[model samples]
Target: MKENIIALHQKNIAKGAEHLFLDKGFNLTSISDISETSGYSRRTIYKYFESKEEILYYLIIEGLDHLVQSIGDAIDSEQNFLKRYEAICACMLFYYENYAISAQSVNRFQSNAPLNMTTSVERIFALGVKINEYLSIWIEQGKEEGILKESLDVMPTVYILSTNLNALFELVTTKGTYLFASLHMTKEQFLSYGYTMNLNSLLKEPTK
Candidate 1:
């Protein structure tokens, strides 16, 4: 009963913080804002979370959990390596579009290492490793099926795919409107081209 109450408080705090972070961004949102939004006093908030960054970390963990599950399900849904790859891409696009704040949390942490690392940070890193492992498994399966180039080094291929895909997602999230307007392209067109281009690079014979 005691544990359940604590979990409840933490959940409420996370919900409120996510809203404020989405509305005003992590850097701009304040503890006072979280307290007011959550209807929890400042003392109660502090008891639950040491800092605002910790709250953001909580959200990141939750988001990455969902992402991992989505990617796993996508891979399981398709026997064809190419189709599985496409499904993974679609899942990432959906995640970034709907969970913008969580996406931003990941990007921010990746670019800037936190000064004082905590257990939450460790978990975040572990989740990242898990994501890379999923990609590695997908690549290995593709190679075994003779779908991906036999000569492809798994880690390097995973690195390229992960890095480039993140870059593409970041570009769309940050500058999609401006870029699409200037290029006379829609977001769907841009992303479709990006996804296909990335997919083609790994095929034993590039897609025509």
Candidate 2:
């Protein structure tokens, strides 16, 4: 089925806003900047988004939607439960790598305008909360398969994993890849090493 006119317009405006954010960081980008990038007049932007804050929140929702779908695809493609964890890790990396331009939008919006995450935004992003659902399914499946520690406290553990993703990716995307490149290691090698390190912490010994 086709999306409604309002949703389609909001998506177009959000896509245009993303371009402006990429050219100039989110904090520096203004409504006029988006209007310039989108070729949509300021009046048109305001028709979909009341302010830059709403635009940032919309981008956050889009980011989360992408992440949850990536995780789902990863889980579906991997047969081994342990390998599925690695796939999920790769999915996380892909999200940041693909959408690095939006990090400032998410981080700054959460920091400077914390109160703007009201019930309306929550209702809007309620489905995007599937990131946790996918993680929970993986953890639960891993525990049953004896690939993850049965005693793993899924919530706190996943919370740490989820919360750290942005900072970790920022390090890699911003400078850590260069650190590895200087050592003659590719970004893939660096990411693989990081995944190994995560497994060493999260995975259980292969039971005979």
Candidate 3:
């Protein structure tokens, strides 16, 4: 069937694109390259995607969905706020360690893409707000249980902590990976650092 053939071609193109994006990044990859790698003709490639930017957009969406799912799965069983936070960190580290090229490609896409750039930025900002809302709920629960600081503004604190974790991971992944494996310039290090910092900042009780 024509539909079946199209589906197969689409799958192959996606696979090839993912490989090239990770290995060569967005700017370096070309339509011809995708055609050769995917065993599809240039015409077929154009039929599916107008340009490399479109391809990058699909990859970004796919990667983010995977990342969100990974984090969701990691925390499904944990009830404690600190433990859940650690689970999130664990998921992020796992992605970085096992899918470094894909992860890096995603970061590059977010930072460099021009088409729909403002829209993409807005989407990310909305996602951050949603994440902060969840963090607020989690912290409020912790306060009710007499575990977290009572005076903490649930939403603001969540936003601050989440921002800090993201920045720290970015630093570790970009510059710290080789400074002794223990230093966690890698994903694992970032996760470990997250746990430590969460325990220090969120889990610690205020003294009377």
In angstroms, the error of model 3 at 11 is 4.0
lDDT of 3 by residue, 91-162 (tens): 656665665544555544335546465554455445444444555666777788788877777767866775
Off by over 4 Å in 1: 108-115, 181-185
The RMSD of every model to the true structure, in order and in angstroms, is 2.2, 3.2, 4.7
Pairs that collide, model 3:
176-185
lDDT of each: 0.85, 0.73, 0.65
Scored against the true structure, residue 142 in model 2 reaches a CA lDDT of 79
| lDDT tens digits by residue: candidate 2, 118-176 | 65477444644567777888888878888788889987777667666656677676798
Off by over 4 Å in 3: 1-8, 74-78, 98-102, 105-136, 155-159, 175-177, 181-191, 206-208
Better model by TM-score: candidate 2 vs candidate 3: 2
Q: How high a TM-score does candidate 2 get?
A: 0.82
lDDT of candidate 1 over 133-180, digit per residue (tens): 888899899889888888889988887997788899989888999999
Query: What local lDDT score does residue 164 receive in model 3, on the 0 to 100 scale?
Result: 73
- Report the error of model 3 at residue 48, Å: 2.3
How many backbone clashes does every candidate have? 0, 0, 1
lDDT of 2 at 55: 84
TM-score of each: 0.87, 0.82, 0.68
Model 3 weakest lDDT span, ten residues long: 124-133
